[model samples]
Target: MDVSKVRKDFHILEKRVRGKPIIYFDSACMALKPKQVIDAVNSYYNDFTACHGRSVHYFSAQTTEKYIEAHRKVERFIGAKENEVVFTKNCTEAINLVANGLKWEKGDRVITTKMEHNSNLIPWMKLAKERGVVHDYVEVDNEGKLDIEDLNAKLETKTKLVSLVYTSNVTGATLNASEVAKICHDAGAMLLLDGAQAVPHMKVDVKKTGVDFLAFSGHKMLGPSGTGALYGRLDLLKGMNQFIVGGETVKNTMLSSWEAEDSPAKFEAGLQDYAGMLGFGAAADYLMRLGMEEVHSYEKKLARKLYDGLKAIPQVTNIYGPSNPEERSALASFTLKGMNPQEVALILDESANIFVRSGMHCCHLYHQDVIHEMHGTIRPSLYIYNTDEELDKFFDALRNIAALA
Candidate 1:
């Protein structure tokens, strides 16, 4: 998709550290901003410089109009209706909003996987603690793939929901959403997907996937931080109770009581992130222009090179997730023999000016259960801005480091 030309859109790519140009492989944790998104964020402060909703001045009017338009932009990007989207602080908040919106009973059950990020795992754990709700975790195999047959056996009539990761941040594994959705529906349970990792790199349609709810962070998808969204079914949202409520969430209020607004507004309580939403919409538009199919194809090619390249190194050991590029995202986690992950990451940056992530990648349960290492593995995740030349540099640097080990 003309990635060489696309690289110019990111000004940070030009920065040099020590003597070498920055080779960013940390897109999984947070993607770098493009100039287009940066400009959109600046437009609010530069052009409007006012609050959204309840204000009728020129700047306020412009802000409200653009703010609503941002929702439409994000909605269209995910194939959702006008008001089906709820803005939040991050994917953690988005998942929490969904988790709290539902009615929890003593025996109500939620089935999730062991490989989930803390954002997905912790909320359900909280539910189990506060309420008498039962949360069951489906196990992953040695390769980090969830056992589908085991998941099917676990589903029951009492299971209220099934939450799963669309793609693992540490393992680089992408689950079969359609298959998971079908089992939950057959068991009379709803499905929620943690889409923080998948939404940025691939095409995801809420209606097509049949998932009732999807949570994702804007920062992971080239948008500003403190911006995220929840895409929920209209029927489900209407039935579900709003978790957070405050300013502009209601039509009327009295000392006696207050009636909340419907759907999105009811879910969104306080003043929103106006500039971040504009940037988030801009990020979605940028990806739309690039076309997700092209992004997916390019990443698959990159993943193959990343997986195979890591495997060829003599001292490299224990690559996480599936070796098949088709079964995973454009990220890999591996530990060097006799070397710690943090030291490995530090050496790469110091010696080669490479930026990579180390540590559990926020999946502690996965580490305790599957890979069996709390120290985690060196991870280099790719995005559209990454180039083949950069990967070659990474591989050469890694080979040198492995020789030292």
Candidate 2:
């Protein structure tokens, strides 16, 4: 799918790391921004730098229109209603908003999985102690697959919410979020999905998934950092309490109390990142032009290549996940015998000019379950900008490292 054209969109690829052309394979951590997103941010600063949803001046109105337009674009991208989308600082903040916004009492249960990033896990854990709620975990199999039976078995009357990661950043295994969402709904629980890794690599329809809530970051999807979104069902958002309150999110204020603004406005307090939101809109437009289906196909092809290449290396061992190409993202997690992951990563960066992430990747609990280490796995996540020639070079480097070991 237009690999050369896609590669040209990201200027970062043109630079050299360690005196060699950069070989970035860390999209799961953060993706490189494209020219369109950059220009969008630049245009905002150059032409319009005014407060949004506050003033009636020309630039202010234009700024407000751009901000609202960005939200509309993001809503369409995930197939959700515009009011359902709430802008946040990042995915971490978005998840916390859900965890904090809910009104809970003693004996209320929140179900989650061990495969979640800390942003998805700790919020519930803290809620358990602070609000007298119960936190339940659905265990994953040794092979990194969700134990759907265990998930069903954990359902109970008091369960309030079910939050899960759409795809594991450590194992590269994708989950059937639609099925999980149905299970949660049947149990009278709202399902909230962490879509950090899934949104960029696959198509997601919040309505089709039956999820009540979903969250993702812009930087993971070719946009700038510090921009994220939380999508909640309109009914739920209407009932949920506000997380932040200020000038933009208040309808009226008395000396002792205040009435909060409407759904999305009540959540987004203070001065928001107008330019970043515009850039995120541009990023969404960019991906939509490439087509999510083509993006998914391209990454799966690369993932298959990576899986096959790693499986054939005698000295390398990969963690359990999707063995077939169909069940994974464009990411690989592995360790080399007789070589520490950190050391291997450093050598790759310093000597071979390769960039890869070699740590827990913010999923320490999942790492403990599989690798039994706190530091976690070495992750090499690919994106559309990567090429088959890059994969071949990666294979050669692995072979050389294997010989040294």
Question: In candidate 1, residue 114 scores what lDDT?
Answer: 85
lDDT per residue as tens, model 2, 164-196: 888888777878988998888898888898999
lDDT (Cα atoms) of all candidates against the true structure: 0.90, 0.87
* 137-247 per-residue lDDT for model 1 (tens digits): 887788888898898899988999999998999888888788888888998999999999999999999988899999999999999988899999999889888798889
Best candidate according to lDDT: 1
Q: Which residue pairs show collisions in model 1?
A: none
TM-score of 1: 0.98
Task: Tell me the lDDT of model 2 at 172.
Answer: 79
Off by over 4 Å in 2: none
